[model samples]
Target: MSDLSATISPAVRLKGVSKTFGPIQALKPVNLDIAAGTIHALVGQNGAGKSTTLGILAGRISATTGDVEIGGARVDLGDPRRARAAGVVAIYQELTIVPALSAVANVFLGQPLSRGYLLSEGAMQSRFAELAGRLGVSIPTDAEARSLSVADQQTLEILRAIQANARIILFDEPTTALAQPEREALFKVMRDLRAEGHTLIYVSHNLDEVLGISDAITVFRNGSLIETRPTQAWTKAQLVTAMLGEEMGDIYHRRPASRLRDGEPAISVRDIALPGAIGEIGFSVRAGEILGVGGLVGSGRSSLLRALAGLEHRSSGQIEIAGREVAWPRTPRAARALGIALVPEDRKHQGLVLGMTAADNVTLPKLRAIARSGLIDNQLAAEVAADATRAFGFDPKRLFAPVGTLSGGNQQKVLLARWAFDRPKVLLVDEPTRGIDVGAKAEILDALRAFAEEGLAVIMVSSELEEICALADRVIVMSEGRQVDHIDASRAELSVHRILNSAFGVERHHHV
Candidate 1:
């Protein structure tokens, strides 16, 4: 063990911490002690009160009842300024960056360096450069936050927290959008911070990641702390059981071998290329097949899906649905008209309207089916929504509730239901199960398989290799905006190692 781990001290302590929002108790009274100079992991499903605990520590929300102590001193748990003063900061998955501002401006937001009413841009830029170098990340300080990638925005968030000299940094699902290489880089930075005697609270749903990076592991379920122990003392199965409150025999359900190779080609892309994003990509998916796209962040997997869905304008090549070539610059409406539907990766922004009711969202794409004399028939729409709710195993009672009010898994089901309603010939789904729990993941995968089994060609892009291996009949590995290799999932040698090797352009040696 390093010297930093040899001398450990309590950095943040919560006594009887609990929170309630009106009729719902988001968190139960809990106690926790985060150690200094160590990476402590908090694992739970969505809505498991992990966010609430972080909120209280960051002073973003007041605890309903309990006390919070930072660095051995009691601090105000409701004032963000007080929390910052006490060196506590939170980096959430949903970035808090100002899009219109420059990276440097965002780094010093709310705490600008000024000299008598005049801002000191040069000083801030110098400091930011130094910090960026120290963290081993390169980011343009002058560029607008909107122009940066999700990974860059997250890097900026960390830079801001480090600039504040945060003693206890709370990270909530920070790597949800990051690729394997980028995640490794972030972990390096985190280790450096730990070596410098800073405390880290990592909250995530990725069990493998928690196991790899955490010194101590804490599991939360239904707003209650289930267990907190050293990572070495727990197995992945134990963690999953603790998180879900039950043993998940097999989270993934593989289709029958007979069904794997049944249908004819339904969607074909011949040498399709997207400007500056994807190179010539050619593939075909049968009517009853799931083609999984796998790659690191910025590897063009998402772009390829978007291109096929007609969400992106292709510079060249051809897309054929049902053996008919589609025109270039295919718009989304055109794609829908051509019997294609896209369930985008960012479901919150692209897939559904948060403010709209679940019923309204379900019927938004096919309002004509529920219309009378060019006017929407409310009764018909409600029936359609109710049918979709039951079809997707969603609660009919929540049909009238805002789509955002539902859980992450339910929201995802709503998106899938919307596209499945039309019964499109080709379904383009990106990150279908991202940010959802194990149970929800199973439900979503089952639904997709059902769709494919019913002769709907499904193209799925997932960061989870296990998902790809289990659900896909074939996998296409992409890297640096091009298709690198393809793997047959039915092969005995199919593994994450083989997929990753193709993803990173590594040459694999196979015994003949």
Candidate 2:
């Protein structure tokens, strides 16, 4: 398929596209169009049919009813090979690269460079090099995919798409795992692709990125397109209103310094080290305080939290609770016994059992409380689940439903409820509001604030600087696996810019 010439016809068009799964209508009849060689952005909350629409265009899923056109030519929307042949490709958030294979092998996994019965490895590597040079990215063609960083993996996916000569490319949350520099590089590549007449569809939750890189923006709410406007004409507040149907003031409910107590620390760590990953980290969280951990990806923020939770063994460290000296917890059960609970980053894989019910999952950690003589008391378990659901503002009726059937926000709430049931002295949460909608984000923050208000020390790790500034009573900036700067929220100098500077090791000069 050749690129579409300059014409009045749209590069891609969807007419009355709709999707339904069982009794739930994921997407209503929606119509959209993208002009040739332009960067179009699709913005919406989670579960707003963004993924469903992308799925239809990428030929991964069949639309219930609709018509799709590429370069003014109707194509089979249900056939993956047909879509690829029509110059359509998508890069999803969850990477699809084969871990054990080399980057060259993964780029051409199914379509190999073969001469009769023999494969040409040299030809594949040379082709990948050419594509990487064209895209202005440095990708290791000979390295194994599993050894590459998340940002490099994404770059490899983009190189593969370019190698296929795709005229239209779709990116789903491409920068979610990238740092500032990597994001800029990706944006430059996207602009270069547009300059070369490739239609690009960008989807992301970061409004600032949409304004910076998109030419046109489309907002979706409740499975329907709210509006489409030029990026220059749209504002962040307007986009938030369109996606959420209302004004959402301050998503992170930061508590005042007065609310944070100066009493003895609930949890204290001295000289925490995780071998070569992180070195000599020290911090303390008092009751009724939210201590924020800030850093770029791979800067040891997540590793620090894991080490504190006893999920990762520390080479050397002393952990104390309520002024009592205790040995390093060797297991998660031991950590919990010492009044510590960890909410992991990947909630779906690490937090919840998908096949189990919400009530069962919520009360899992506290089974002993609701059991008698090693027998689970069903009524008592249900009551505990009910109390937890109510405390977190989750629906009680949904407790009986399968955990997998719930939305991302509800699933996150289920995890929080489980940890809250234990009444731990300290809570370690990694990315509490990631991949959740704006409204759900507000609710989760409020729940954490409530927990802190009830005298529970909370340690949170997040990549979003805005989240760290909004929710933390104090922020610890980590760089190269070490804490470099500490900013107290009570002081006016604690801003997102300062946090970013600290993370990047940039020295800021203050006017005397």
lDDT of each: 0.83, 0.84
* Cα TM-score per model: 0.87, 0.89
Cα RMSD to the true fold for all candidates: 4.1, 3.9
Worst 10 residues of 2 by lDDT: 1-10
lDDT of 2 at 327: 88
Give the backbone clash total of model 2: 0
* Residue lDDT tens for model 2, 1-512: 11123354788888888998776687888888888888999888766777788888988878999899998888886866777899998988788898999999888877888878999988898898887887788877889999998888888877778778789999988887777888899899899999989999988878899999998888888788788887898999999999999987977555666365679989888888888889768888899998999878889999888887778855568988999989888678888889999999988888899999999999988789999899999998999999988877787877888897676778999999997787899999999987676767788888888888889999999877788787788888888888888777887767888888887878533211
lDDT of 1 by residue, 396-484 (tens): 87788889766677899899888777788889999988878776787888898888878888899988888888888888888888787
- For model 1, the superposed segments whose C-alpha errors exceed 4 Å read 1-9, 59-62, 72-74, 79-82, 99-102, 133-152, 258-262, 314-316, 325-329, 370-383, 390-400, 405-407, 490-494, 507-512
Clashing pairs in 2: none
